[model samples]
Target: MNKSKIVVIGGGTGIPVLLDALRKENIDLTAVVTVADDGGSSGKIRNAVNIAPPGDLRNVLIAMSDMPQFYADILQYRFDETDGPLAGHPLGNLLIAAVSEKQGSISTAIRTLGRFFHISGNIYPSSDQALTLHAVFEDGTEVAGESSIGKHEGLISHVYLTDTDTGGAPIASQNVVNCIMDADMVVMGPGSLYTSILPNVVIPDINKALLETKAKVVYVCNIMTQRGETENFTDADHVRVLHEHLGKKVIDHVLVNIEQVPQDYMDNNAFDEYLVQVKHDFAGLKEQEVKVISNNFLRLVKGGAFHDGEAVAREIMGLSKRQAD
Candidate 1:
């Protein structure tokens, strides 16, 4: 019997948490990470070297590595401003950028590092080239760059890649499309909706592969609404936006947190980017024809609310089993 093949799509802190848990499972795992980031040390490196942002990819790689924790820590270590040329950059990001330059592509570099780190699963960038996320606001104003989108006060009408002059439709690598098409289950999100997850799916080939694939599509909704991105958004609103972009109800299951967050547990100073808990909309989710898997998926740690990765992984494994049966 073959192990179940699961493909997870997203970037940022959330996906890495989930990946860390899933790596222990007896399954074939593939991670499709977004490369549209242009912030912090990643932004600086991208501007300086014209490479895809390595921040998220670096985290994902570390999560999947079976190497010693000390090595992972070394890779994640950051240099302060006092470090001169290396200041503000994490060691992992710099290594990935260096390998990408040497290998001549981000995808090749990721594979090379995956072997070096003995990563448990595959990691592929959604695109090989650098991508800029461009959003059009409700007032018809436009904002360019993934880092800049959240700062706008107005509601976002929609977002697209600015890589092309024709339609701004970004392209995904064949490996990315093939992973989605071949997986037994494809998991989306647990990350920023617009910037993290959407950037990967908005690519025409990827969206089409998702619609065409027979794999069970599961969306892991965020535990909290993002301040500048998804303030006051309900569970259904998250699914709705995904469907609106895909042009159909492609989501088969939505894993949502049913547990209530403790009122004072959240420290705004620590989690300044998070706004409030995402409201539940069971009826609305049903209206969209998505099977809702609501559970106590909350994990509160260090004054921040997050998904319990093990619990979520169990549910995902169950879904994969049912799909196989």
Candidate 2:
């Protein structure tokens, strides 16, 4: 009997939520996190150090680890404004930077920290080196950084990756391609479509694996449309963009949230990206020739809308079972 291997690809808060739930399940779970982040503490760290951005990985590691709340709190602690030069950085990010400097690679740093965190699932960055995301808007204009891309208000035609320091083409991190090809299933998204999810698949080697892998590729669609990214996009539009990138309808299943967010429930002040609920087009989805797993997967907290991690994980687990059986 062979255990099912599931590889999830993406970053940001959404992927971590799914991972947090998947960590408790019995299977071979691994995360392929995006390294195209260049904002906030991650940007500060990337500019100062040569390591891959640690912010996403920090959130990911904490979510998937067996660490107690107390230790997780310690790692998540942020320096207040009173702390000169250290303000806005998490303790975990600093720790990752320190270890990466000693080991000469962020991949090594992730492995070392994974053991300390007592993580059951493996975590791998999409690329070994830091990545810069460049977006081409509908007007043929180009924006150079991931931080800036989110701020630029235009329909993004496409996004591509490059090495942060040397401006060379980006490659998949070691073992990332192998993990994808050998997996029983691959999950993508429920995160920022352009910045978090696309950053990983847009890498050449990763794209090839997705195209060639026998694994059932599933896309967990985001509940809310994000401004400056998937604003005004339907569930089908999201699928179309992904298919356009991969050159075919590579996604086998797409999980859509049929549940509606309560009226005026979103706190746009804190999360400006929560622009509107994503519209659905089942006919459009059918045109893509992929299975749609529609359900009431909404989970709200303090006026913020999110996916029910355990619910989504259960659905994925069921799919894996069906595949294995």
Candidate 3:
């Protein structure tokens, strides 16, 4: 079977999980990861060295890794036990930082890792800029950075890049454009709305490339609501936000999970995890002219309804093939 090229756009935990599923399908995957993370070891490294965020890219690479049982563990290993400077940092984050220094750019470093780990698919940053995310609240308040906005407890009215004119890592942007142009389908989201998904769309060249691409655009909606960013967002609310950001005509389909989440799972983590319950709103999505593919997409993760990456990937493959037919 000829491998169909796919461009998956997202960041953080979601991308890695999605890639893991897609890689097993033997598809030619190209991940366009957001670079707006401003917390954890990624933030520490980027701020100190004036470099773009590497955490998302690192996660993507692990998702596509051929030897995940080996290199994946090494890459994700975190230091602890001592109060040293590197105590809280993940080994993967540090390695990526070193690679960035040695190779002179994040893209170059990722390409090297891709080769070293024999990653099943290619991964690229959405932009080269060390960009920051700013969210405008319904009350006209603005919050900058992922960490700050997560705790804002306000409705995110709009989101945009702080500086769209700032140059991106040329290699990453080129790869993203090329993937979009060549792909049979482009997958967006199943990640954070403001920081992960919007950050990528706000990149000037990336958005232009997406608009120009002829590929079928599929938005894999998130399973649960986010507190400050997407407080009351239904499935339709998710689609509307993207349409408002990227325009209505850009998206072709929306994949939503219709299966109900287990009550006990939510009960355990509701308070500690700051998790928000997301209910299916089929009528709302249908109103926007988006054909919704409803499925069971929730996985029990530490007592919560998080996206089941493998299930999502299987649906994506099935839908793409059905479209092709």
Candidate 4:
């Protein structure tokens, strides 16, 4: 069977897990990652080097890399010297920083590294520029950075790019458009509602392509709600926010988790949990004309909630087959 071309739009931790699972199947995958991250090692590099953030890109790359001997750990390696100028930084991010300087473009740097790592899939930033996200709180306070908005304690009124019409990696935009034009399926989310997922769709040209694409648009709803990001978001709330960003008619399918989590887990991570224990409203999705596919998406662990990569891969593969039929 010929591989189905798939374009997955998202960023950060969730994207890599999804990409890792999807790459294991016989499919062509393109990950369009967000560049608005101004936190952790990615933020440091972006602040110092004035280039696209590499943390998200690096995570996606490692996720899509061939396993057993790949640079997954190396890419995620953080300096712990605790006393040096270069301490507390991730090596992969720094490598990207170095490459961006030498190559003079993030796209060039990542492309060069992609070949080096023997990555089977493509990873791209939603934009090539180092951009900040701007949002106003419902309480009338304005927030400028993604990290700051995340830490704020109010609902967001609306969100947009800081430099309207400025800072996009044209190559990434073109890549996303091409992927959409050629894809059998284009999937978004299952990541952070505001930060990881919406950043890609908010881009003008990218959203236009999404609207115009002939591909089936599927939105994977987050398994948890994020504090400050989607404080009161339900499965319906997540889809609504997406439609608010991409228009109502743009999304075709919504993938949601049906497995119920323990209340203890919910209470413990209440401040940090993105997906609460609230029962998802199926009627809400039906009202939006969005088809919902429910499955067991939760993975219980020692310290965090995670999507079962293998299970997610199986689900996506099944969805692809259904689309083919």
Q: Scored by CA lDDT, what does every candidate get? A: 0.91, 0.92, 0.80, 0.79
Residue-wise C-alpha lDDT for candidate 2, range 1-325, written one tens digit per residue: 7779999999989998899999898899999999988998989998898789999999999998999999999999999978999999999999999999999999999999999989978999999899999999999999988889878888999999999888999988769999999999999977999999999999999999999999999999999998888889999999999998887789999999999898988988988877899999999999998899999899999889999999999999999999998
Q: Per-residue alpha-carbon lDDT of model 1 for 1-325, expressed as tens digits? A: 8999999999999899899999999999999999889999998988887788999999999999898999999999999989988998999999999999998998999999999999998999998878889888889999999999999897777887855323365778899999889999999978999999999988889989999998899999999999778888999999998998888899999999999999988989999999899999999999999999989999999999999999999999988888888
- In angstroms, give how far residue 82 of model 4 lies from its true place: 0.8
* Model 3 regions more than 4 Å off: 163-172, 267-274
Worst 10 residues of 1 by lDDT: 162-171
Q: Please, what is the TM-score per model?
A: 0.97, 0.99, 0.93, 0.93
Q: Report the C-alpha lDDT of model 3 over 104-188, residue by residue, as the tens digit.
A: 8888889998898888878888766577778888999988787788878668888877542353333237778788888999999
What's the residue-level lDDT of 94 in candidate 4? 90
Which window of 10 residues has the lowest lDDT sum in candidate 4? Answer: 163-172
Residue-by-residue lDDT tens digits, candidate 4, 168-267: 3332357777787788889886688788888788887788888888889888887777778877677887777777877756788888888877666644
Q: Who wins the lDDT comparison?
A: 2
Q: Which clashing pairs does model 3 show?
A: 128-168, 128-169
- Candidate 4 Cα outliers beyond 4 Å, as residue runs: 67-70, 164-172, 266-275
Candidate 3 lDDT: 0.80
